[model samples]
Target: MNFLDGILFALFAEADKSAPLMVPDSVQKANFAETVRKLANLDVDQLLQNLLSESVWILIKVLIALAIYFVGRWIVRRIIHLLDAVCERRRVDVSLRSFLRNTVRVVFTLLLVLIVVSTLGVNVTSLIAVFSAATLAIGMALSGTAQNFAGGVMILLMKPYRIGDYISAQGQSGTVREIKLFSTVITTVDNQTIYIPNNSIATAIIDNYSTADVRRVDWTVGISYGDDVDTARRTILGMLAADPRVLREPAEPVVWVSALADSSVNLTVRVWTKNTDFWDVFFEYNERFYKELPAAGINFPFPQMDVHVKNE
Candidate 1:
């Protein structure tokens, strides 16, 4: 008999206490082997059916997730495009408009990702928690950058300065070239480009030269003490009057004796001109004053020293 037959026969003998057991070991072994085989077959069949059903369900979920992603992305793009059209119609500032577009896209994309994760049976709450922690860590790591971003947003909203406006801040003067999320780009008079942090600019004093429609140009002209102050003032006034760009109604060109220097009389000439023509008017007036003053018998005083040395 096989090992299974021997084991089964011994078990039967132990159960019967009144008389010795006489069952054949071969039959017991065969019966036990057949039962085990039947159970194994049944389990294998059940397991295969369950696996196939689960695989189909998982595939359907995956397809649904993919569909949601594509449709959601298309919707987001359409909404952003519509917003752009509205902003353009409203004549929104370009800097703020671009910032809004990017912000909306990022927020919507994140929402879409969460929806997709949920469709795929992922725990969204846990995902959100993880993202929150990551964001906090990143914010801590880049505190200054975050401050600059906030400052930029404030600047765009408040409009302290706009593109093409000449500004002086932090000891630097230039025309605003671009306003970004974290920095402002400026182009200097000499064609040099500079990038200033938004935080610094927003917090510090800003002098915007182009905020007004017109600007005042002031020049101090010095003439020899012997020269006629009236003649000098008249000459300067005539030059200003000749410039068509100079504004007259609000306040005409002002010329007055500002001071009496050691060897000359200083005349302060103030004129109002359109912002666009300010620089041109300033240079033109300066050149004319220097050239015409001498022709009008107005002498510019120069420092002179005369020493009378005796036997000392």
Candidate 2:
């Protein structure tokens, strides 16, 4: 046999020369209690041989377990790399690729651990039972975390928004920077970072501004009531037409008298432009309307009170 086995055999041969160990009559009759009692009566030579034999078997088992673990790790890495290549060929989203890779790694690693434990002679069935019970208890205690995790999966699948998309949800609006397993990170217009739980975002009303190629910009321009409505409309339309960023095919820019308030007549102007140019067109046109309308002899309205004194 091997070196360790040969050594053990030699030791056992020497131990056999000692006075033959007494066998209890109950043990001969296959009584478990008598077998246990006979174990206490084992001579020093017999006990030493038994301990060495068991220890050698355990060491061999440990070596085999270590070999499996190391080989399994190498195989796991190759599998994950192949998975990444497949995902890339399928054109998966960057966030989704990360999630899938991590999930596969965890599942494979857990299976490897189980295999190693089984090699060590652990009872797989009892271990699974204990694991299941512990998992149930933890799930009950961390319900919110579990919900968030589920929500993350939903977000990745449903794709309500993606990284770099500007979205407004749960009373927070920002450009998404990352979509993690539990939360989404966004950077606000003012450059503030916000972490929103995926659960809340999934259930909230999401306004994804980046979904559409073009968006409508609306502004209300108020002029003095006496100002000519036709002139004001023409002036606003001219300004819209002058801006190259404004879209003209699907929708044409239009202005209408929306409200005749106490001080002014409000003209609502609506125009379509590329999403990227929405804010630029709105802010620039606001200043343009202020300067161009007044220059066109249309005065802005101001609050005024009429007073008449009656002398008795």
Candidate 3:
């Protein structure tokens, strides 16, 4: 053989002596079986110890979360009590105080829940996202109720009417009893209870009669055309002067000839009185005018027409 042949023969011999690169199927199976055996023979005591440690850690977290919740609840109650005392000291309105208290409680409770959940290793961001989505869905579902809630906030803030105030709104007239989160409760003159939605009342015109210390009472008295107007006026003026509830500071009672109708003359009587005495004075004086005017030689004229008949 030549030198090149000798070199090639040496290379082939070296290649023949080298081990195969790929492992056999039998060797792979043996290795897998050996690995599974090693795993199965692992120390059971150590595994149990690891599991117990994990459980203890979880228990500690749970206990901590409970502690936080209880502490937060106590703090929230203390805060609410302080707020109530402050409100009382300031003499805040009942409706506003109630609203503020409820709002503060709810806000603090939600914050406490979030904090407790975070202490439990819960993802607070994900929970808040979930809460936000749920709130949006609920808001859309109860849009009218949401509007009423907002209206209630506005009503409490603006103070258009308060408890025990006689108010007229949305074709309902009553004395306000309670201002709630979504509605206003009122009692009518006839002793009927009504719940008016705050959204409706907030947007409607509200006539509060109890706001002013005094109110004006007006009456229209009609007498026959030929009856003595001066006598009727004098009689009404005397009755008004005798009433102790009538106010004289702003303006004294006055009678004016308002209009002359076909059969009778109309006299306008205006008087001022305390708000509490308005209705009583108005009704009592009406009966007095009906009886006293006639006793004073004044006549109440009814609509009458003369009929003429011609016989042919």
Best by TM-score: 3
For candidate 1, lDDT tens digit of each residue in 212-310?
Answer: 998888999889978898888887778778878989957999999999877778899888888999899888878888899899899988966668989
Output the better candidate (1/3) by TM-score: 3
In candidate 2, position 93 carries an lDDT of 90
- lDDT of each structure? 0.86, 0.87, 0.89
Q: Using alpha carbons, what is the TM-score of model 2?
A: 0.70
Relative to the true structure, candidate 1 reaches a TM of: 0.70
Per-model root-mean-square deviation over C-alphas: 10.9, 8.0, 13.1
List TM-score per model, in order: 0.70, 0.70, 0.71
Residue 286 of model 1: what lDDT? 85
Which ranges in model 1 have alpha carbons more than 4 Å from their true place?
A: 1-78, 93-95, 112-124, 305-312
lDDT of 2 by residue, 120-222 (tens): 9999999999999999999999899889989989999999998889999999999998887788889999999999998999998999999999999999988
Enumerate clash totals for all models, in the order shown: 0, 0, 0
**lDDT leader:** 3
| Model 3: lDDT of residue 172 | 94
The Cα error of candidate 2 at residue 274, in Å, is 1.1
Between prediction 1 and prediction 2, the one with superior lDDT is 2
